[model samples]
Target: MPVVREFTLPDLGEGLTGAEIIRWLVEVGEVVAVDQPVVEVETAKASVEVPCPYGGVVTARFGAVGEEVPVGAPLVTVAVAASEGDDDAGGSGNVLVGYGTAGHSAAPRRRRVRPVQTRPAAVPAPQPTAQPAPRPARSGPLPVISPLVRRTARELGVDLATVSGSGPDGLILRADVTRAAAAVVSRETSAAAPEPAVAWDDDVVPLRGLRRTVAEKLSRSRREIPDATCWVDADATGLLALKDQLAARAAAPRIGLLPLLARICTAALARHPDLNASVVTEPDGTPTGIRRHRAVHLGFAAQTERGLMVPVVRDAQLLTTEQLAAEMARLTEAARTGSLTPAELTGGTFTLNNYGVFGVDGSTPIINHPEAAMLGVGRIAAKPWVHDGELAVRQVTQLSFTFDHRVCDGGTAGGFLRFVADCVENPGELLRYL
Candidate 1:
């Protein structure tokens, strides 16, 4: 006798609830080893490979690629051979998020086909044409793994089991449920022979995955945080010169304008620690006090194909210009490649956004939730500016600072922005802070 055990999706940590299946590495009836990566899933944070903790023949898979599966939901079922005198089904002694390793009763076994039992019966005359038996009806969970799909079906009053799935191995997707619902509406309209004057679902884009997370956080930030934005037109001539000088050096690491701006932001934060803190909330979600941070974990926004993401650079205040440039480059590459982990995507006391890359002059971007401030830099171009009491062509840029008004008064925010602007106008001013 073989014992079948169901494996549920494990938590991927960092408070993630679910993940979208990117690819399935295993197929039904295939032999698998303990701790083998069965599926690659893309969470809001990163793409991760999920391993199965059971070693046996895979009997069934619940979700298809592109379907989201919640934590603790059934992922796959494996059939393990029962050892003699052992009643328990063995599990692999491998530990992953949401589950721990456990002892097994028997060693691993190879996969084999089960023998069919035969019974003697009286033979009957065969018909000239034999028709094949109908396919067995699928039941028990509807092959739908996503809760979103189930909820959509229920809200639209669609029978999930009756609709054929277009996904791999007949797994029901959200689109399938929606199409079934649309068919029902079509039939209803055909009976009435009428047309409506409005389209509700047209041009509607779903907010899911990273976009959904960003929307919720931004909405909360706008609703709760009293934000104020201040802008300054600064002469970035010196900063560009400084970057050129560093790049012209023999051994100095090639520096960009962002590293210099990052340095300036850190210096300003150090001077005005009030803007570097987040508000601490009580149990009921009311602001109780401010929790000032001693170190700066800086987050910088990077635009990727998925959407906008903020990747944090830890202990940014302590790193040099070269080091900051290196870390920023590394994080930007990871963000572009969708390889950043959840840890790298969150937990920042401040954010630095360089919207200049997009050729925009300035923007009042919403503050990243739980963070106190965000510094935005716009494109630096040659503009007429006052230099040495005379109008001259200078490399000018727009800098905007959006801060939580509750964290500090306008004087503090103004002073911080002024200091950053001064640093941009005179790159030598950073030496005083150093």
Candidate 2:
């Protein structure tokens, strides 16, 4: 006899409530060891491998690949072999998504025995008049974490209690609430005159994984934050010369314009710490205050096959230009391969977006939500500029700064932007801070 233990999905971090199963690493009836990865799931943050805490034969799996599983939802059941002297079969002492090994114990496995049937006289069937009993209500907290989902439900006057959840463990998802609201609207519309049907030929690409997350985040940023952009065209000839000088050193690594800009941004942020923070909002989404961070956890925009990802370089204020270049290169590779973890993709105090690679001159970048500001750099091109009181061809680039209005006044924002432009136009200005 073997005791079966059930495992549920665990919270992956960053307030994420659920994950979509990408693929199953283990199948039913397969033997698994403790802490072995059983499935790969894609959360809004990143794609991650979920490990099992129990070591045994997998007896049952709860969700199929492509299905969304909420935190605390049963993922798989494992049957452990009964051991001598112990009344219950024990699980491997492992900690993962849900269960841990502390004071671990197993319950008795209940076996269902089939009843034997014997030949008997013909029996008549009863009339089917009795009504079926209603299904029991599920107990525990509703499977929902996003404040946006709750707000949408409240605005639509949808009763969350009445609607059933399709997510793991009967968790109520935004889709579930949306469907219920649509049903109500449909009934009301049917009561009045029906509208004419339109031809439908457009293809719907189901937004999933990272793409869906990015869409929701950008939408929320637009809806909630009052943001403003300030830009300036700077002469980058000095910055290019500085880069060339650094690259000429025997010990120096290849230097790009981004690392130089990143170093300038960090220095600028130190001078104006207000731009290196996030606004603390009240429950109703009102800005109560701003929380300024001391250390700079810098994030840079990286384009990948999955989609656009901003990988944060932790303790960026402490890293040198060469180190920043190396870290950025590493993260870019991770992003391209979809190997970045949630921790790597999040916790960014400020973001620096370099859209110059796309050959754009300037763009009013949307501030990455929760962060106070973002710095956008455009392509550096040779243009006629005033040098030594004469017009000459010089390297010129545009810098755009977007900031949350609630965080600081325009004057502080302007000062920060001006500092960065000064450093860009004269790389020597950064040496004082260095």
Candidate 3:
């Protein structure tokens, strides 16, 4: 008899306890190789392709697409052929997602797996696609992860104890609870009840995945941080001239406006270090003061097809204009393709948001949580301004700075914003820091 081994979902990223199933790479009764990607999942941090450690016949798969599965929940079961001398048959030596160990190896070969109807005790059985039956009387703590899921169940008034879990070890997933809630509505409706005269046409979108994560983060920021915004109109003619000058140079790296502003930000942060720090809070949300980071892990906003993501450039204060341009370009491409790792998306002392791309003049952006401040750059356009006592059409832009009031008062914030504005007006100001 072939031995059936279960493979559970592993932690995909730092602090990510669960992930939503985006796609399935393997099907039931399919032959799989050890360390082969079995499924694709999206967490709050990033999207990841998780590989299975066991190589054998895939006997069963749990969780449907769009379903959220918690870490350590069973994902799939593989049945490997029993062989002489090997205590664990069809096992893998490599552990990709925190499961499996060395010594066992199985080649990609066909194995006669019993009927799919017979699954291991850990594998979840399929449920009715349309209205699932009410969850039977079960006894145990609800195997649930991700507070978002629990909140969804609670908001929908679905009794989790009565809902059947389609995840390994009967772990309840978001999709399962949603289905159970729908089943309750179906059971309560009367077949003879008259239908609506005209069907409602409103499209309802449930906040999930990245959108939900962003909502929660922004809400937390509003609740925790007593934030304030300061704005300054800057004369950007010098900055644009410098950009032109650099472009005119022989074999100079193509630098964008963002990198130049980023360079200025680093210099400005050096002068006002308080803006480059995060407030430390006790677990119960008690303020313990602020943590000043020596190295500037600069985060910049990158809008992608999925959503808005802030990709951090670590130790950005050490990089020059050319280097910052290169790093920003790489991270922007990764963000567009949804290939950024969790590390690339987090740990920032400050953020730079260029809303100018959208042709916006100004915006009061909510500070990226945990970070003390964010500098918003508006569109640079030709505006009439007094230059050297003469009114001339000069390239001008609005700079909006949002900072945590808890970290610094208006004086420090004004000083930082003024430093950035001066750098924009006189690119020579940055030479002092360089």
Candidate 4:
């Protein structure tokens, strides 16, 4: 008798209820060792590869790629135990390495109630000589475009079918809709005729994946947490010069402003520990006060192929600027290629979002969950300002900080921002503190 065991999907941590299957590395009839990677799953924040927990011959796979599987659902099964003295009877032919134990009893399998398939009544076969009728001409309302475009067209009172499309395969775009509206205006003016204004048709967009997660998180953050935003303009001339000098130096490691920003934030947290804390409420409807953290795990908001992901640099306060830069680069590359592990995406004590790369001036970024504050860096631009009692051109950047008012006081937040600004303005000062 052979005993089989089924391995179910384990919680990848962070209380995630489910994940989308990205790929399956194992197949049926293949022997696998414990801790061997078997499947890749994509959560809202990141994609993670999961290792098998049992050693045995793979008997079945429960989920397909791109399908979402709930936590504790059976993912794969293996035959681990066999009758004694059955080695010559095709029992346990090969033992998997790294798996010390065997012959574990399998859990009771859950039977899914699949819908019964019924044979459909056979239809009379069509004659071979019968010709198919041509499709009816698209009339009346001009075969309305997509619901989104149709709503825009109706709101502008422009006929979509008459509008020329510049999109691929002659599909209408938002720009085409705007142009059609303008053309209608011009034609009505020339003909001295009045056109009736049309109202927009109701439209809907399905929320899924990152967009859906973003919506839910943001809504909860806004409704539950009281947020306050503070803005400051900083002189980045010194920072730019330092970056260029470092890039040109042979001994200095190549780096960007992001790593420098992370270092500054880590240092600032030491002074204003309140901003480094989170507000947690008790289950009995009582609000427990601020909780400050000791470790500085800085989360860097990275834009990836699937969506936005934040991978943390653990204990950034202890790392040298060079080490921080190298780690940031490695983690960023891993995020872009979907190779980041689950551990890398968790335990962030603070977050830094670089909107400067996108040429944005400033934005109030939402704090990553459980972190009280987040900082946004804007584009550095040359502008005229009064310096040393004289008008001079200097590189200036905008800083936006959003914090949970429940945890961080306005004064503490202001001081923290000023500290970061000081670090950016005086690069040499960082070395002294370090």
**lDDT head-to-head 1 vs 3, winner:** 3
Best candidate, TM-score-wise?
3
For each candidate in turn, give its C-alpha RMSD to the true structure in angstroms: 7.4, 9.1, 6.2, 12.4
Compose the digit string of candidate 1's lDDT tens values, residues 1-434: 56666666665678887888888898777888888988878887777777777877777676656677776666777666665114443366453554333233132222212222231122112223222332332776466546688887898898877877655345567878877888788676666764653433444466667788889999989988999999999999999999999989979777888888889989999999998899998766689999999999999989999889999999999999899999999999998988888889888999999999999999999999899999999999999998999999998999999999989989999999999999999989999998
lDDT of 1: 0.79
Q: Candidates' TM-scores?
A: 0.81, 0.73, 0.82, 0.68
* C-alpha lDDT values of all predictions: 0.79, 0.78, 0.80, 0.70
Candidate 2 per-residue lDDT over residues 1-434, each given as its tens digit:
66666677765557777788889898767888888989888888888777876777776665556666666666777776545114343344454433333225242222212122231122112223232332322655555544545776898799777777664345455666776887787676666645674333334465877899888888878988899999999999999998888888878677788888889999999999989999898877888888999999999999887889999999999998899999988898899888898889989999999999999999998888889899999999999999989999999999999999988889999999999999999999888998
Q: State the displacement of the C-alpha of residue 236, model 2, in Å, after optimal TM-score superposition.
A: 1.7
Give the TM-score ranking, best first. Answer: 3, 1, 2, 4
Deviation in angstroms for 96 in model 1?
A: 5.7
Q: For model 1, what is the alpha-carbon lDDT of residue 28?
A: 72
Which residue ranges in model 4 land beyond 4 Å of their true spot?
Answer: 1-5, 26-36, 53-59, 78-214, 284-286
lDDT of 4 by residue, 23-117 (tens): 88887667777667778877665667677656666765656565566666667766655542133332232222321122322433333222223
Task: Provide the lowest-lDDT 10-residue window in model 1.
Answer: 111-120
Model 4: lowest-lDDT 10 consecutive positions: 93-102
What are the per-residue Cα lDDT tens digits for candidate 3 across 267-342?
A: 9999999888999999877789899999999999999999899999999999989999999999999989887888
Deviation from truth (RMSD, Å), model 2: 9.1
